[model samples]
Target chain A: MTSLLYKDWSIIKKTRALYFSVLYFSLIMPSFQNMDFFGKSFLANSYYIFIIYLLFSYLTAYDYKYNSDNFIPAFPVTKKQIVAARYVFVALTFAACLVLQSVVRIVILVLKGQDINIMNIMDYGQAAILILVFSLYFGIVLPLYYKLGYQKLRLLMIGAAVISGTVSSVLSEVGLDMNRPLVMLFAVIISAVIYYFSFTISVNIYKNGN
Target chain B: MNKVLEVIGLEKHYDNFTLDKVSFSIEPGYIMGYIGPNGAGKTTTINAILDIIKPDKGKIMLFGKELNGNACEIKQRIGFIIGENAFYEFMNAKEMAGIISRFYKRWDWGLFNKYMREFELDPGKKIESYSRGMKVKFALACALSHHAELFILDEPTSGLDPVFRSELMEIFQQIISDGEKTILFSTHITSDLDNIADYITFIYQGRIVFSRDKDSIMTEFALVKGRKDQRDMVLGSGKIKGMLESDVGFSALTDDRNWFFRNAPGSLVIERATLEDIMVHFVRGNKKYDKLAI
Candidate 1:
């Protein structure tokens, strides 16, 4: 599993220039003070989710470009292990993006001579929403990719991106309050169930697929 | 004899092709040449053995253990070079090797470096820049770095220069020289297997034509050339497995060389069939006898 993670990292390392540009854009977007609060929140949250999507896309593209799907199975790893590594990679990317965003937020607040609240409710709610959105999108995308290869699922991926974007925009537009701890807990539980089933389906699809 | 790999009654079906009841085995300390024409299920059989593709009905055993549920464990003892390029093209050979090394328990860095130097591959050069031959060499280097007991190579000699192809064959010979390693080499270039392969397994239209000792196969089949009139005699004798008739003369394949020698006219010329001759005749000729009568 660690090797699979390392393989993903190696692929990312090859596109260092492009990744750096994306990271620079992500870091500087939070510092733009001219935007309204809603706009600012939307930009930051979208970037957070987009980072995970971009990383997954890059890894999957690399796999397709190099025909890794044909060779990876020859390795001494089970289909379950491969699927588990992908899920773990998603989790790690989310964690890393959260840490980076939090650090950037702190540095921006400190430079502006503002107080930082370590236990901010809004911050927690936004993070939970981001996780839920990613979970929902990947829950649908990953298993489809395992069943039908990337080439066959290209149009479906675009459709999924559009649907997920509209869903996120609608949730923001309605301002549905997720401030309650119970609601956030329920969202997490639902997302967890979706992810677990997605992982199971992906394993079976990959095991039976060529 | 200690069998390192055994595939029994393997069957897979697609809309246009089906690997029907394919079966073969390879003993330790020998090379088995898997020769077949295009779309003959060579890659399918290898994929089934490697578990890259699932077979509907078959049993594959490696090292005396079933490979169905124990693929991960059994794969550790096997090395594979399946496609034209098996590593990430964006990464260099060294980085790819480093990543692959972590997957196997018996990966040898020293051996990998040795192959890297021997193959003249620069560790810093990206794989996309490498030529087709270089890519194959890099894959071969990685496949050999681990202390794997079995090697399954698909078209490893294709696209390589004759010098390197023979050199790679020599390396294969050296790999099994210790009487521990085994190889199942699949290639359309049958000449590469002429000097190295111990057993020959031929597949055509998703069926195994013959699987026997290479020497016996070579001796058992003969390419007979004579006038077109002899075609009826050859076909009537039931010794002609495959035949082609042209304007001037006709050529046919037969397993019973003694029958042809005794029955063929003095004007006919009989010669031993090379692997290519056998494959071409079997694949291109009529399927009157789908199975090898021998």
Candidate 2:
């Protein structure tokens, strides 16, 4: 499993996109003084974007680059081990982003002479939860890629994200409670459902004949 | 002898292509050559055998057991080298080895190092920096390191130079020399099979054309050259599978080389067919067969 994680890390590190995306979000966006938090919270929340788009792109690209299906299927390790390693890879990247985000947050606060309080940590924690929640999107959507192939699934996911976002906007316009506690609770429920479904789908995907 | 790998009636269907009931077996002590042209279902057959894709029909037996239920156990003894180099370009050979070693129960550090040394592969160099030959070498080293009972190689010689190709063949020969190991090597290069394969299986259009002993295949077909009229007469005899007609004359493949030599010594020139010749004949024949049906 350690080997698998190392393999995943090594693969993702090679891609310039991963580094640039993570660095831009985790370290760059958070430091911008004039950044409108309400207007660009999604962008400012680099941790969330890193987990969703970057990490998803990384894992998806990893399969194509390394022929993960060809190599991993041949190994003695079980499908469970392979799926576990994938999660670990995503988790490790999230952890790295957290550290980078914290350092950037501290540096930005020091430069501005602002009090870096527990509230800041809490904000970071919220971002971390959001990242985890978004990873649920990856877990649920990625397994479909095995069946549909990457190009098709990619377009499908893009369409799904757009449609879902549009629906969410319409719901919010109708006064759906998207306040902090409600959003957090919804995210938790969605994450749990996604996790359970992802695990099941991953197994089915592994067993699927290409 | 225990069968190390057995593929029976494995079938996969797509709108554009279908792998038609392909079957073959590798025993514990011999090498099987899986030979075909591009788009001939070599990789698909292998994918099915490995259960990377589920076959619509049939079964794959590995290590004397069914592959699905016994996948982990079977995989433990199987080392596969895919046709393509799919390693992380940034990771050096050492890191790649380090990562792969964790998954195998019988991973051998000393053997891995020995293979690296033998192949002159510098494990410290990143895969992106390595030449194609070096990448193949590194992949080979990884395939051989663990205590594998079976080695499945997909187009292992595609980019290799002649010298390295020979060296790789020697390693494969050495691997199976112990008599406990088996190999199923897929390649478009027939000469490699001529030198290494104990048995040969030819595939065309996602179907097995033939699977037989290398010796038998070699002995079966004779490349016969002759006048167009003479070849026509021979063709009329109904044993010819490969026939090429030209302005000057005709050359064809005959099942009985000795008979052609004996019966048409002055009419046709009989030549021994090498594996390459056999491959050319089959590939051409299959194409001609398709065209005629259309």
Candidate 3:
């Protein structure tokens, strides 16, 4: 397991361009905007960062298909270790993104003479909730991407997301808070359930991936 | 006397392909040549052995243990080199080796570097910059560097030149010289196996047609060529599996080589069958015991 982690870390470092780009957009770009716009921009910035992280996570699944990490499976490593290492890698990536986001938020507040309430109890609570939701959402998506493959799932995911977003926008004009915090909470629960199943499916698929 | 790898009744079902009760065993100190034509279930069988694809039914025992429980432990002693250039294109050979080294507990960096030098592989260049032969050589270096007792290779010689192929074979011979390691090499390159394999297993249409000692298979199966008039005489013998008849005469596969040598005595060519000829004869479905040229 440690070996797997070391391998992934080295790969991630080698491909640091992707990581740096994400950091630049999420953490560096927001500071260039005015103070009054910081709060509003924060929401879009966070969501954009989430989307990019999700895409990177989805793309990492191709490591299996392309045989990038093919030799690892043939080593003295169990399937469980392989999956756990992957999960840990995702967790670390997200953690790095979160830290970058936090640093940017702090810098914006300082430059704006804003009340230092950003990291307050409510703010921390919201951040914690968002992390939980995003983690659960990704836990459901990453393994499926690995099993179904990147090409098929990438098209399906984009198509489905587009259709669903359009429908949700039209419904919101008719008065819908489906994107509200409460709804997000409920969705998180549902994602957790799906995540459990997806995890099991990936385990079975990988065990049989020869 | 230890059976390093044992596969019994292994089957994998696909929409277009079904691997039937395929079975073979590799004991320490011998090289098993897994020969077959394209899409002949050679890779599928190897995949099942490595648990890459779960078998529909059957048992795979490695190191005297059930495969499921001892996968990691069993895998530790095993090395694999697939036909595909499976590494990331962005990674140089040194970086790739470092990544690979972390996976095995008994990785020997010194030995890996030695093999890389021997194979003329540059460890600092990205795989994308490598020629096909270089990629193969690099992969082989990484695979053999670890303390592997058994090596499973799929078409390791496919794109390599004859000289390098011979060099790689020599390496395998040296690895097994101590009589404690084993190799299971699957390839369509018959000459590679002909020069090295102790046991030969032929797979056809997802099933094992035959697996025997190399010398025994060579002695048992004979390819006969003759003219058209001898067709009846050959068919009368009823020893042919199947035959292909052309304008020049016929070519066939037969188990009774001696019978053909003694009975069909006119203008017949009884040659020592090469591994490639045997593979082609079986795969072509021309099983006639006697091959008569018309």
> Could you say which candidate leads in lDDT?
1
Cand. 3 TM to true fold: 0.86
Q: Is the docking of candidate 3 incorrect, acceptable, medium or high quality?
A: medium
**Candidate 2 regions with alpha-carbon error over 4 angstroms:** A13-47, A78-84, A91-136, A143-190, B261-266, B286-294
Model number with the top DockQ: 1
Report lDDT per candidate.
0.82, 0.72, 0.72
Tell me the spans in candidate 3 whose CA falls farther than 4 Å from its real position.
Answer: A26-65, A69-71, A109-122, A156-197, A208-210, B285-294
| TM-score for all models, in order of appearance | 0.93, 0.82, 0.86
What is the docking quality class of candidate 2? medium
**What is residue B34's positional error in candidate 1, in angstroms?**
0.2
Candidate order by TM-score, decreasing, is 1, 3, 2
lDDT of 3 by residue, A1-210 (tens): 988887777666777755666766666556443444433334443453345455454446546455754455666778778777776666666566656666677766778777765233123433434555455555655676667766666656554434433333233335333334455456456646665666677777777654
Best by TM-score: 1
Off by over 4 Å in 1: A21-25, A31-34, A37-40, A155-159, A172-186, B287-294
Cα lDDT tens digits, model 1, B19-38, are: 99999998899999999998
lDDT of 1 at A193: 91
Mind giving the per-residue lDDT tens digits that candidate 3 earns over B1-294?
668888899888898998999888888899999999989999888876775656889999987888977788788788888757747668888988887888888999999999988988788889879987788778878888898988898888898899889988998899899998999999999999886899999998898988888998788778788889876776667776557678979876677788888888868776677888878767674544434221
- TM-score (chain A only) of candidate 1: 0.83
